[model samples]
Target: MRLAALPRRPSEPTITLINVVFLMLIFFLVAGQVAAPVDRDIQLIDAAALATRAPDDALAVRSDGTTLWRGEVTTPEAFAAARIADGAEVLRLVPARDLPAQDLLRIANALRMAGAAEVRLVTDRSAP
Candidate 1:
Protein backbone atom coordinates (compact mmCIF):
# COMPACT_ATOMS: atom_id res chain seq x y z
CA MET A 1 0.00 0.00 0.00
CA ARG A 2 2.64 2.54 -1.07
CA LEU A 3 0.10 4.64 -3.03
CA ALA A 4 -0.19 8.43 -2.40
CA ALA A 5 -2.65 9.32 0.42
CA LEU A 6 -5.97 10.57 -0.92
CA PRO A 7 -7.12 14.04 0.21
CA ARG A 8 -10.17 14.07 2.53
CA ARG A 9 -13.35 15.16 0.78
CA PRO A 10 -14.68 18.38 2.30
CA SER A 11 -17.91 18.07 4.35
CA GLU A 12 -20.91 19.27 2.27
CA PRO A 13 -22.62 21.63 4.79
CA THR A 14 -23.78 23.88 1.92
CA ILE A 15 -26.23 21.21 0.72
CA THR A 16 -27.83 21.09 4.21
CA LEU A 17 -28.04 24.91 4.32
CA ILE A 18 -29.65 24.94 0.86
CA ASN A 19 -32.18 22.30 1.98
CA VAL A 20 -33.08 24.33 5.09
CA VAL A 21 -33.48 27.50 3.03
CA PHE A 22 -35.77 25.72 0.54
CA LEU A 23 -37.85 24.23 3.36
CA MET A 24 -38.27 27.65 4.95
CA LEU A 25 -39.23 29.15 1.62
CA ILE A 26 -41.97 26.51 1.12
CA PHE A 27 -43.22 26.96 4.70
CA PHE A 28 -43.44 30.75 4.28
CA LEU A 29 -45.30 30.41 0.99
CA VAL A 30 -47.95 28.23 2.68
CA ALA A 31 -48.11 30.46 5.76
CA GLY A 32 -48.49 33.61 3.69
CA GLN A 33 -51.46 32.08 1.83
CA VAL A 34 -53.33 31.33 5.07
CA ALA A 35 -54.08 34.96 6.06
CA ALA A 36 -54.35 38.37 4.46
CA PRO A 37 -51.70 40.88 5.48
CA VAL A 38 -52.82 43.95 7.44
CA ASP A 39 -50.99 47.28 7.54
CA ARG A 40 -49.16 47.62 10.85
CA ASP A 41 -49.15 51.44 10.82
CA ILE A 42 -52.93 51.84 10.43
CA GLN A 43 -55.01 52.08 13.59
CA LEU A 44 -58.32 50.18 13.40
CA ILE A 45 -61.49 52.00 14.29
CA ASP A 46 -62.88 51.37 17.80
CA ALA A 47 -66.54 51.94 18.59
CA ALA A 48 -68.31 51.19 21.86
CA ALA A 49 -71.87 51.13 20.52
CA LEU A 50 -71.61 50.04 16.93
CA ALA A 51 -75.05 49.27 15.52
CA THR A 52 -75.50 45.83 13.99
CA ARG A 53 -77.40 45.43 10.77
CA ALA A 54 -80.42 43.28 11.43
CA PRO A 55 -80.89 40.40 9.02
CA ASP A 56 -83.68 41.19 6.56
CA ASP A 57 -84.54 37.60 5.82
CA ALA A 58 -84.71 36.45 9.42
CA LEU A 59 -88.04 35.75 11.14
CA ALA A 60 -88.74 38.01 14.12
CA VAL A 61 -90.38 36.67 17.27
CA ARG A 62 -91.95 39.26 19.56
CA SER A 63 -91.85 39.22 23.35
CA ASP A 64 -95.48 37.99 23.31
CA GLY A 65 -94.65 34.94 21.11
CA THR A 66 -95.96 36.54 17.92
CA THR A 67 -94.02 35.68 14.76
CA LEU A 68 -93.40 38.31 12.07
CA TRP A 69 -91.81 38.00 8.66
CA ARG A 70 -90.66 41.31 7.21
CA GLY A 71 -93.10 43.16 9.51
CA GLU A 72 -96.04 41.03 8.41
CA VAL A 73 -97.66 38.65 10.85
CA THR A 74 -96.61 35.05 10.10
CA THR A 75 -96.65 31.65 11.70
CA PRO A 76 -93.84 29.11 12.05
CA GLU A 77 -95.43 26.71 9.57
CA ALA A 78 -96.06 29.51 7.07
CA PHE A 79 -92.53 30.88 7.46
CA ALA A 80 -91.04 27.47 7.03
CA ALA A 81 -93.18 26.82 3.97
CA ALA A 82 -92.22 30.16 2.42
CA ARG A 83 -88.51 29.64 3.08
CA ILE A 84 -88.54 26.09 1.81
CA ALA A 85 -90.44 27.17 -1.27
CA ASP A 86 -87.69 29.70 -1.90
CA GLY A 87 -85.07 26.92 -1.74
CA ALA A 88 -83.80 27.97 1.66
CA GLU A 89 -83.05 25.15 4.09
CA VAL A 90 -81.49 27.27 6.83
CA LEU A 91 -83.67 29.64 8.84
CA ARG A 92 -82.61 32.70 10.79
CA LEU A 93 -84.65 33.84 13.80
CA VAL A 94 -84.42 37.17 15.62
CA PRO A 95 -86.13 36.92 18.99
CA ALA A 96 -87.05 39.88 21.14
CA ARG A 97 -84.78 40.73 24.06
CA ASP A 98 -87.52 39.84 26.53
CA LEU A 99 -88.80 36.77 24.70
CA PRO A 100 -89.17 33.66 26.87
CA ALA A 101 -86.81 30.71 26.27
CA GLN A 102 -89.70 28.24 26.18
CA ASP A 103 -91.43 30.19 23.42
CA LEU A 104 -88.24 30.24 21.38
CA LEU A 105 -87.80 26.50 21.73
CA ARG A 106 -91.45 25.88 20.78
CA ILE A 107 -91.12 28.06 17.70
CA ALA A 108 -87.85 26.36 16.71
CA ASN A 109 -89.44 22.95 17.09
CA ALA A 110 -92.39 24.00 14.96
CA LEU A 111 -90.09 25.28 12.23
CA ARG A 112 -88.12 22.04 12.31
CA MET A 113 -91.31 20.02 12.10
CA ALA A 114 -92.36 22.14 9.13
CA GLY A 115 -89.13 21.17 7.30
CA ALA A 116 -86.35 23.58 8.19
CA ALA A 117 -83.02 21.77 8.12
CA GLU A 118 -81.30 24.23 10.43
CA VAL A 119 -82.43 27.14 12.58
CA ARG A 120 -80.13 29.94 13.75
CA LEU A 121 -80.86 32.75 16.20
CA VAL A 122 -79.51 36.26 15.55
CA THR A 123 -78.53 38.54 18.43
CA ASP A 124 -76.50 41.65 19.02
CA ARG A 125 -72.81 41.56 19.84
CA SER A 126 -73.34 43.64 22.97
CA ALA A 127 -73.54 41.93 26.37
CA PRO A 128 -76.57 42.67 28.48
Candidate 2:
Protein backbone atom coordinates (compact mmCIF):
# COMPACT_ATOMS: atom_id res chain seq x y z
CA MET A 1 0.00 0.00 0.00
CA ARG A 2 1.37 3.49 -0.88
CA LEU A 3 2.03 5.80 2.08
CA ALA A 4 -0.57 8.51 2.44
CA ALA A 5 0.66 12.13 1.83
CA LEU A 6 0.85 14.35 4.90
CA PRO A 7 -1.91 16.90 5.16
CA ARG A 8 -0.90 20.55 4.62
CA ARG A 9 -1.54 22.98 7.51
CA PRO A 10 -3.87 25.92 6.87
CA SER A 11 -2.42 29.45 6.92
CA GLU A 12 -2.92 31.58 10.02
CA PRO A 13 -5.93 33.92 10.01
CA THR A 14 -5.22 37.52 8.89
CA ILE A 15 -7.96 39.16 10.96
CA THR A 16 -5.42 40.93 13.20
CA LEU A 17 -3.54 42.51 10.29
CA ILE A 18 -6.75 43.47 8.55
CA ASN A 19 -8.07 45.05 11.74
CA VAL A 20 -4.88 47.08 12.18
CA VAL A 21 -5.00 48.34 8.61
CA PHE A 22 -8.66 49.22 8.90
CA LEU A 23 -8.00 51.18 12.07
CA MET A 24 -5.11 53.11 10.47
CA LEU A 25 -7.25 53.96 7.47
CA ILE A 26 -9.97 55.25 9.74
CA PHE A 27 -7.51 57.39 11.72
CA PHE A 28 -6.16 59.19 8.64
CA LEU A 29 -9.62 59.65 7.20
CA VAL A 30 -10.88 61.36 10.33
CA ALA A 31 -7.73 63.39 10.77
CA GLY A 32 -7.83 64.59 7.19
CA GLN A 33 -11.08 66.44 7.86
CA VAL A 34 -9.50 68.77 10.43
CA ALA A 35 -7.07 71.26 8.86
CA ALA A 36 -4.41 73.05 10.86
CA PRO A 37 -5.02 76.78 11.14
CA VAL A 38 -2.88 78.71 8.72
CA ASP A 39 -0.11 80.82 10.21
CA ARG A 40 0.46 84.21 8.54
CA ASP A 41 3.94 85.02 7.33
CA ILE A 42 3.85 88.13 9.49
CA GLN A 43 6.10 87.80 12.50
CA LEU A 44 4.22 87.69 15.79
CA ILE A 45 4.91 90.45 18.24
CA ASP A 46 4.78 88.98 21.71
CA ALA A 47 4.05 91.47 24.43
CA ALA A 48 5.10 91.50 28.03
CA ALA A 49 1.38 91.84 28.64
CA LEU A 50 -0.83 90.13 26.13
CA ALA A 51 -4.52 89.92 26.90
CA THR A 52 -5.71 86.64 28.33
CA ARG A 53 -8.79 86.94 26.17
CA ALA A 54 -8.51 85.52 22.69
CA PRO A 55 -9.35 87.64 19.69
CA ASP A 56 -12.06 86.57 17.27
CA ASP A 57 -9.88 87.18 14.25
CA ALA A 58 -6.10 87.71 14.01
CA LEU A 59 -4.32 90.13 11.67
CA ALA A 60 -0.57 89.83 11.55
CA VAL A 61 1.71 92.71 10.56
CA ARG A 62 5.27 91.87 9.64
CA SER A 63 8.29 93.91 10.66
CA ASP A 64 8.64 95.09 7.08
CA GLY A 65 5.08 96.37 7.28
CA THR A 66 3.70 93.51 5.25
CA THR A 67 0.28 92.21 6.19
CA LEU A 68 -0.65 88.59 6.57
CA TRP A 69 -4.06 86.96 6.41
CA ARG A 70 -4.30 83.47 7.78
CA GLY A 71 -0.51 83.26 7.44
CA GLU A 72 -0.45 84.59 3.90
CA VAL A 73 0.36 88.11 2.82
CA THR A 74 -2.80 89.97 1.89
CA THR A 75 -3.99 93.51 1.46
CA PRO A 76 -5.80 95.14 4.35
CA GLU A 77 -8.79 95.82 2.14
CA ALA A 78 -9.08 92.18 1.14
CA PHE A 79 -8.63 90.84 4.65
CA ALA A 80 -11.05 93.28 6.19
CA ALA A 81 -13.63 92.68 3.51
CA ALA A 82 -13.45 88.92 3.96
CA ARG A 83 -14.00 89.09 7.70
CA ILE A 84 -16.81 91.61 7.46
CA ALA A 85 -18.47 89.70 4.66
CA ASP A 86 -18.24 86.56 6.75
CA GLY A 87 -19.97 88.45 9.57
CA ALA A 88 -16.96 88.65 11.82
CA GLU A 89 -18.21 91.16 14.35
CA VAL A 90 -15.05 91.35 16.38
CA LEU A 91 -11.59 91.69 14.87
CA ARG A 92 -8.22 91.58 16.58
CA LEU A 93 -5.05 93.25 15.46
CA VAL A 94 -1.88 91.37 16.34
CA PRO A 95 1.01 93.39 15.10
CA ALA A 96 4.65 92.68 15.72
CA ARG A 97 6.27 94.75 18.44
CA ASP A 98 8.68 96.16 15.91
CA LEU A 99 5.78 97.11 13.70
CA PRO A 100 5.61 100.89 13.36
CA ALA A 101 2.78 102.83 14.90
CA GLN A 102 1.84 104.02 11.46
CA ASP A 103 1.34 100.47 10.23
CA LEU A 104 -0.84 99.68 13.20
CA LEU A 105 -2.90 102.76 12.46
CA ARG A 106 -3.34 101.64 8.89
CA ILE A 107 -4.69 98.30 10.04
CA ALA A 108 -7.12 99.96 12.40
CA ASN A 109 -8.36 102.16 9.63
CA ALA A 110 -8.91 99.17 7.40
CA LEU A 111 -10.83 97.35 10.11
CA ARG A 112 -13.09 100.31 10.60
CA MET A 113 -13.68 100.58 6.87
CA ALA A 114 -14.59 96.89 6.79
CA GLY A 115 -17.36 97.69 9.30
CA ALA A 116 -16.11 95.58 12.17
CA ALA A 117 -18.46 95.81 15.12
CA GLU A 118 -15.45 96.07 17.44
CA VAL A 119 -11.72 96.26 16.82
CA ARG A 120 -9.31 95.37 19.57
CA LEU A 121 -5.56 95.80 19.49
CA VAL A 122 -3.62 92.85 20.84
CA THR A 123 -0.73 94.04 22.93
CA ASP A 124 1.11 92.47 25.79
CA ARG A 125 0.40 94.15 29.09
CA SER A 126 3.25 96.13 30.55
CA ALA A 127 4.92 94.63 33.60
CA PRO A 128 3.22 95.63 36.83
Candidate 3:
Protein backbone atom coordinates (compact mmCIF):
# COMPACT_ATOMS: atom_id res chain seq x y z
CA MET A 1 0.00 0.00 0.00
CA ARG A 2 1.27 3.51 -0.82
CA LEU A 3 1.60 5.74 2.27
CA ALA A 4 0.28 9.33 2.11
CA ALA A 5 3.08 11.89 1.91
CA LEU A 6 3.51 14.07 5.11
CA PRO A 7 2.20 17.60 4.67
CA ARG A 8 4.95 20.26 4.63
CA ARG A 9 4.88 22.83 7.55
CA PRO A 10 4.22 26.44 6.58
CA SER A 11 7.23 28.79 6.62
CA GLU A 12 7.56 31.06 9.67
CA PRO A 13 6.03 34.55 9.13
CA THR A 14 8.71 37.26 8.54
CA ILE A 15 6.25 40.14 8.10
CA THR A 16 5.94 40.53 11.89
CA LEU A 17 9.66 41.10 12.28
CA ILE A 18 9.71 43.57 9.40
CA ASN A 19 6.82 45.47 10.95
CA VAL A 20 8.52 45.63 14.33
CA VAL A 21 11.77 46.90 12.83
CA PHE A 22 9.93 49.50 10.76
CA LEU A 23 8.06 50.70 13.85
CA MET A 24 11.30 50.99 15.83
CA LEU A 25 12.87 53.03 13.01
CA ILE A 26 9.91 55.39 12.98
CA PHE A 27 10.02 55.77 16.77
CA PHE A 28 13.71 56.71 16.74
CA LEU A 29 13.26 59.17 13.90
CA VAL A 30 10.47 60.91 15.78
CA ALA A 31 11.92 60.84 19.32
CA GLY A 32 15.58 61.53 18.58
CA GLN A 33 16.70 65.13 18.96
CA VAL A 34 18.35 66.66 15.90
CA ALA A 35 20.95 69.23 16.82
CA ALA A 36 23.46 71.22 14.82
CA PRO A 37 26.88 69.61 14.67
CA VAL A 38 29.46 71.44 16.75
CA ASP A 39 33.02 71.87 15.63
CA ARG A 40 35.34 69.26 17.12
CA ASP A 41 38.04 71.79 17.97
CA ILE A 42 35.76 74.15 19.84
CA GLN A 43 34.95 73.82 23.53
CA LEU A 44 31.87 75.28 25.23
CA ILE A 45 31.77 77.19 28.49
CA ASP A 46 30.13 76.13 31.73
CA ALA A 47 28.06 78.37 33.93
CA ALA A 48 26.34 78.03 37.28
CA ALA A 49 23.23 79.90 36.17
CA LEU A 50 20.45 77.92 34.58
CA ALA A 51 19.42 78.73 31.04
CA THR A 52 16.06 80.46 30.94
CA ARG A 53 15.19 79.16 27.47
CA ALA A 54 16.51 77.28 24.46
CA PRO A 55 18.00 79.07 21.50
CA ASP A 56 16.32 79.22 18.11
CA ASP A 57 19.68 79.22 16.32
CA ALA A 58 23.31 78.88 17.39
CA LEU A 59 26.58 80.62 16.38
CA ALA A 60 29.84 79.19 17.56
CA VAL A 61 32.97 81.21 18.35
CA ARG A 62 36.31 79.48 18.56
CA SER A 63 38.89 80.20 21.23
CA ASP A 64 41.01 82.05 18.68
CA GLY A 65 38.10 84.45 17.94
CA THR A 66 37.04 82.88 14.67
CA THR A 67 33.28 82.73 14.26
CA LEU A 68 31.37 79.82 12.80
CA TRP A 69 27.92 80.36 11.45
CA ARG A 70 26.12 77.08 10.95
CA GLY A 71 29.51 75.30 10.94
CA GLU A 72 30.96 77.52 8.25
CA VAL A 73 33.56 80.12 8.95
CA THR A 74 31.85 83.50 8.68
CA THR A 75 32.36 87.14 9.44
CA PRO A 76 30.12 89.44 11.40
CA GLU A 77 29.11 91.31 8.25
CA ALA A 78 28.21 88.11 6.43
CA PHE A 79 26.35 86.80 9.44
CA ALA A 80 24.41 90.05 9.62
CA ALA A 81 23.53 89.87 5.94
CA ALA A 82 22.41 86.27 6.16
CA ARG A 83 18.66 86.14 6.14
CA ILE A 84 17.23 84.92 9.39
CA ALA A 85 13.94 83.13 9.74
CA ASP A 86 11.10 85.60 10.04
CA GLY A 87 10.01 84.49 13.49
CA ALA A 88 13.51 83.83 14.82
CA GLU A 89 14.18 86.49 17.40
CA VAL A 90 16.73 84.82 19.61
CA LEU A 91 20.32 84.04 18.59
CA ARG A 92 22.46 81.76 20.73
CA LEU A 93 26.19 82.32 21.04
CA VAL A 94 28.34 79.27 21.81
CA PRO A 95 31.85 80.44 22.59
CA ALA A 96 34.89 78.40 23.53
CA ARG A 97 35.48 78.04 27.27
CA ASP A 98 38.85 79.79 26.91
CA LEU A 99 37.61 82.55 24.60
CA PRO A 100 38.13 86.04 25.97
CA ALA A 101 35.10 87.80 27.38
CA GLN A 102 35.87 90.87 25.25
CA ASP A 103 35.55 88.86 22.05
CA LEU A 104 32.27 87.45 23.29
CA LEU A 105 30.98 90.96 23.93
CA ARG A 106 32.04 92.09 20.47
CA ILE A 107 30.14 89.24 18.84
CA ALA A 108 27.09 89.92 20.96
CA ASN A 109 27.17 93.56 19.95
CA ALA A 110 27.43 92.64 16.30
CA LEU A 111 24.50 90.29 16.58
CA ARG A 112 22.47 93.00 18.30
CA MET A 113 23.30 95.42 15.53
CA ALA A 114 22.35 92.74 13.03
CA GLY A 115 18.79 93.04 14.33
CA ALA A 116 18.59 90.08 16.69
CA ALA A 117 16.06 91.01 19.35
CA GLU A 118 17.70 88.72 21.85
CA VAL A 119 21.14 87.13 22.09
CA ARG A 120 21.49 84.30 24.53
CA LEU A 121 24.83 82.97 25.67
CA VAL A 122 24.74 79.17 25.72
CA THR A 123 26.70 77.64 28.56
CA ASP A 124 26.79 74.24 30.17
CA ARG A 125 25.25 73.99 33.61
CA SER A 126 27.97 73.41 36.16
CA ALA A 127 27.69 70.14 38.00
CA PRO A 128 26.23 70.48 41.47
Candidate 4:
Protein backbone atom coordinates (compact mmCIF):
# COMPACT_ATOMS: atom_id res chain seq x y z
CA MET A 1 0.00 0.00 0.00
CA ARG A 2 1.19 3.47 -0.91
CA LEU A 3 1.57 5.93 1.93
CA ALA A 4 -0.51 9.16 1.89
CA ALA A 5 1.54 12.34 1.12
CA LEU A 6 1.44 15.21 3.67
CA PRO A 7 0.07 18.57 2.51
CA ARG A 8 2.57 21.43 2.19
CA ARG A 9 1.89 25.01 3.29
CA PRO A 10 2.75 28.17 1.27
CA SER A 11 6.10 29.80 2.15
CA GLU A 12 4.62 33.19 2.98
CA PRO A 13 1.16 34.81 3.10
CA THR A 14 0.12 38.37 2.13
CA ILE A 15 -1.35 38.88 5.60
CA THR A 16 2.11 38.67 7.16
CA LEU A 17 3.39 41.54 5.01
CA ILE A 18 0.38 43.68 5.84
CA ASN A 19 0.84 43.04 9.55
CA VAL A 20 4.52 44.02 9.45
CA VAL A 21 3.75 47.29 7.60
CA PHE A 22 1.04 48.12 10.06
CA LEU A 23 3.34 47.56 13.02
CA MET A 24 5.99 49.81 11.47
CA LEU A 25 3.44 52.55 10.90
CA ILE A 26 2.38 52.41 14.54
CA PHE A 27 5.97 52.48 15.74
CA PHE A 28 6.80 55.61 13.73
CA LEU A 29 3.66 57.40 14.83
CA VAL A 30 4.49 56.75 18.46
CA ALA A 31 8.25 57.36 18.32
CA GLY A 32 8.24 60.50 16.16
CA GLN A 33 7.40 63.97 17.37
CA VAL A 34 4.55 65.73 15.60
CA ALA A 35 5.35 69.36 15.01
CA ALA A 36 2.98 72.17 14.20
CA PRO A 37 2.85 72.96 10.50
CA VAL A 38 4.41 76.14 9.18
CA ASP A 39 3.23 78.22 6.22
CA ARG A 40 4.88 77.27 2.94
CA ASP A 41 5.21 80.90 1.91
CA ILE A 42 7.47 81.71 4.86
CA GLN A 43 11.14 80.98 4.21
CA LEU A 44 13.32 80.65 7.30
CA ILE A 45 16.76 82.12 7.43
CA ASP A 46 19.73 79.76 7.31
CA ALA A 47 22.21 79.48 10.16
CA ALA A 48 25.35 77.48 10.69
CA ALA A 49 24.18 76.28 14.06
CA LEU A 50 20.54 75.80 14.98
CA ALA A 51 18.29 73.45 16.81
CA THR A 52 17.32 70.29 14.97
CA ARG A 53 13.67 70.45 15.97
CA ALA A 54 11.16 73.29 15.78
CA PRO A 55 9.62 74.71 18.92
CA ASP A 56 6.00 73.99 19.84
CA ASP A 57 5.16 77.65 20.38
CA ALA A 58 6.71 79.40 17.39
CA LEU A 59 5.75 82.84 16.05
CA ALA A 60 6.26 83.39 12.32
CA VAL A 61 7.27 86.81 11.11
CA ARG A 62 6.96 87.75 7.45
CA SER A 63 9.41 89.87 5.50
CA ASP A 64 6.91 92.73 5.44
CA GLY A 65 6.76 92.83 9.26
CA THR A 66 3.50 90.85 9.38
CA THR A 67 3.28 88.33 12.18
CA LEU A 68 1.37 85.05 12.36
CA TRP A 69 0.16 83.92 15.73
CA ARG A 70 -1.33 80.44 15.92
CA GLY A 71 -1.82 80.43 12.14
CA GLU A 72 -3.73 83.74 12.22
CA VAL A 73 -2.36 87.06 10.99
CA THR A 74 -1.95 89.54 13.86
CA THR A 75 -0.08 92.68 14.71
CA PRO A 76 3.07 92.46 16.81
CA GLU A 77 1.49 94.38 19.65
CA ALA A 78 -1.54 92.14 19.73
CA PHE A 79 0.54 89.00 19.57
CA ALA A 80 2.82 90.26 22.32
CA ALA A 81 -0.12 91.20 24.49
CA ALA A 82 -1.73 87.79 24.11
CA ARG A 83 1.53 85.98 24.75
CA ILE A 84 2.21 88.10 27.82
CA ALA A 85 -1.26 87.47 29.15
CA ASP A 86 -0.78 83.76 28.61
CA GLY A 87 2.43 83.99 30.65
CA ALA A 88 4.66 82.59 27.95
CA GLU A 89 8.24 82.57 29.17
CA VAL A 90 9.92 81.65 25.93
CA LEU A 91 9.03 83.20 22.57
CA ARG A 92 10.28 81.34 19.49
CA LEU A 93 10.58 83.67 16.52
CA VAL A 94 10.68 82.19 13.00
CA PRO A 95 11.35 85.09 10.73
CA ALA A 96 11.34 85.08 6.92
CA ARG A 97 14.72 84.90 5.21
CA ASP A 98 14.31 88.33 3.65
CA LEU A 99 13.25 90.00 6.87
CA PRO A 100 15.58 92.84 7.83
CA ALA A 101 17.80 92.46 10.89
CA GLN A 102 16.39 95.67 12.33
CA ASP A 103 12.87 94.34 12.04
CA LEU A 104 13.84 91.06 13.68
CA LEU A 105 15.60 92.89 16.51
CA ARG A 106 12.59 95.12 16.98
CA ILE A 107 10.29 92.17 17.35
CA ALA A 108 12.69 90.53 19.78
CA ASN A 109 12.83 93.71 21.81
CA ALA A 110 9.06 94.00 21.83
CA LEU A 111 8.72 90.41 22.99
CA ARG A 112 11.21 91.06 25.79
CA MET A 113 9.25 94.11 26.86
CA ALA A 114 6.09 92.00 26.76
CA GLY A 115 7.54 89.73 29.47
CA ALA A 116 9.20 86.97 27.51
CA ALA A 117 12.24 86.00 29.49
CA GLU A 118 13.88 84.23 26.57
CA VAL A 119 13.47 85.02 22.86
CA ARG A 120 14.66 82.14 20.73
CA LEU A 121 15.26 82.69 17.03
CA VAL A 122 14.56 79.63 14.92
CA THR A 123 16.58 79.27 11.76
CA ASP A 124 17.07 76.60 9.11
CA ARG A 125 20.24 74.54 9.33
CA SER A 126 22.70 75.43 6.63
CA ALA A 127 23.73 72.71 4.21
CA PRO A 128 27.15 71.22 4.83
On a 0 to 100 scale, what is the lDDT of residue 66 in model 3?
96
Local error of candidate 2 at 54, Å?
9.9
Tens-digit lDDT string for candidate 3 (8-35) = 9786579778888999998888777575
Pick the winner on TM-score between candidates 2 and 4. Answer: 4
Model 1 misplaced regions, further than 4 Å: 1-53
Q: Compose the digit string of candidate 4's lDDT tens values, residues 1-128.
A: 99889898886878899999999999888777575668999999886455444344678888998888777887666776777678877778999889999999999898888778888888877634
Best by TM-score: 1
Which tens-of-lDDT digit does each residue in 8-119 have in candidate 2? 9776579778888999999999898887856877677787456543343677777788877776888877878888888888877878778888878878888788787787
Clashing pairs in 1: none
What does candidate 2 score in Cα RMSD to the true structure? 15.6
lDDT of 2: 0.78
- Root mean square deviation (Cα) for candidate 1: 7.3
Clashes of each: 0, 6, 0, 0
Score residue 16 of candidate 1 by CA lDDT: 91
Error of 4 at 127 (Å): 5.9
Give lDDT per model, in order: 0.90, 0.78, 0.76, 0.80
lDDT of 4 at 14: 88
Write down the TM-score of every candidate: 0.59, 0.51, 0.50, 0.51
